[model samples]
Target chain A: MEEEAETESITLQDSAAGGRIDGKWGYIWGAYSVTWVLLVGYTLSLVLRGRLLRRSSGVER
Target chain B: MKLPFAWEHLIGVIALLLFCYGQVFGLFMVPPDAHMGDVARILFVHVPSAWNAFFVFTIAFVCALGYLISGRKGFDHALEAALEVGILLTILLLMTGSIFAKPTWDVWWKWEPRLTSSAIMLMTYVGVVVLRSVVQDNERRAVWSSAATILASVTLPLTYFSVQIWRSIHQIQTSPADIDAPLRMAWRINALAVLLLATWFLARRWRIAARRWELGDAPPLPEPLQPEEV
Candidate 1:
């Protein structure tokens, strides 16, 4: 009986986690993720530009 | 004669302090929106970024005009500083707006009037930069760029009011007459954030310009750039 209860509890926890994950409005997740990706990409571009500028200036010198 | 002063570091320090203070105030002190819950917190970043983008463009417009009228290197330097800062701030504005839109509007991207107009404005400045690269003569580049900047400035008001003039997916940026207290506080924090970012970018870009000039690679502000030899 104890083993059965333990299994039942585990199943219930798994279902609860699944519900939380699936129940969320999917569009919100897409919006947040896309924004994060774009912002990071832009930051990387800025860094690369700075590095290139530095390299080219060094070459000129 | 007294030497020309550059207070780049001093301005940067002040801007950094403001950003820190704005962040703290935004995340902690501002009350959450009852309708949108804690997700509305993103406004603290988004609204400020939009403001800075507009403000920087205005500075670029004015500086471009000054450069054309005075034919001075200082004005050109100011215009370049404003352009670099404006582009970065415009990018920040778009990123923040899209991020904030998710919880509020339920979409990552929308064909909203304000959003479309702002994107076009940014692209126009980018076109100006490309045009400068294609032209070999410095004087011609400056003259053409100044014209572009002037045209861009004239469109600023229309872009700002586009939403009001036509129906859009977005609402008016800010309306104190309608907003509740919690939302108002959030908007104030956003305003502070915008000011902080503007100061920071302006100072940093100015320092970068100064270093470029010191390195002797930057185009002379007063002398028009001559055509390059093959």
Candidate 2:
């Protein structure tokens, strides 16, 4: 009986997650991921550029 | 690890923490809109990016005026940093706006006044940078770019009021009554986070410009094509 109850609970949890499966979640996830990825990527580029400039110019400060 | 410290890095860390808080709150805690549902959550980022883009451009405009008046490199460096950051934020605004539009508007892009004016505003600043690259003299580059920035800034206002001035499919600004208190809080938190991030960006970029000028390592210009001997 406990095994049957566990299976039922698992099924219920899957249905609760159905919102993510809908197409709308893809848009939401894509927007958020892209925003962060681009922002972080630009930050990294600035860091790299600064280092490159420092090294190339031989300014070891 | 004893990391060598800079105050700007501290600002960055704080901004990062706030960003995570705001992102989680908007993504998970906030309730979905009645009509737009989960898609409305995107405005938490998009609206802030738009506001901050306008903010930086305003600073850039003021810096341009300062440089013209004072003939100071300080103003010029600030102007350069602001333009680069304003470009980044505007790009973010447009990209996220398009992302939000795909689900809600059923199109990745639309030719509405708000969207069209925004693209022009972005191109205007980018053009200043491109023009700066072409001019060989440092003083000429600074003066011309400042003049260009001052003139181009008019587009910023045009972009801001495009929806109100003309018939646009894009929705105008929403009032407090339009959303719940929690939604307002999420938006404000994200706005602050983005503002700090932009400040850090401006400071870092300004330092780089100053360093380049100090090192006499400004970017090399292409030599004008030599006339072939007849």
- Give all candidate RMSDs, comma-separated: 12.3, 11.1
Per-residue error for A55 in candidate 1, Å, reads 9.9
Model 2 interface DockQ: 0.15
The residue-by-residue lDDT of candidate 1 on B126-229, one tens digit each, is 87777756765556666888888898786678778987776455655456876777567666765764565456556555554544544454432324347783
Q: Indicate the fraction of true inter-chain contacts that candidate 2 also forms.
A: 0.32
lDDT of 1 at B230: 19
Q: Runs in model 1 with CA error above 4 Å?
A: A1-61, B1-6, B177-186, B210-230
Candidate 1 per-residue lDDT, tens place, A1-61, comes to 7975575455434433322222232433443454345444644554455465566566556
Give the alpha carbon lDDT tens digit for every residue of A1-61 in model 2: 7975575445434433423323488878887998898899989988987876776566334
- Which lDDT value does model 2 have at A49? 75
For every candidate, what is the interface RMSD in angstroms? 11.8, 10.2
Candidate lDDT (C-alpha), each: 0.64, 0.84
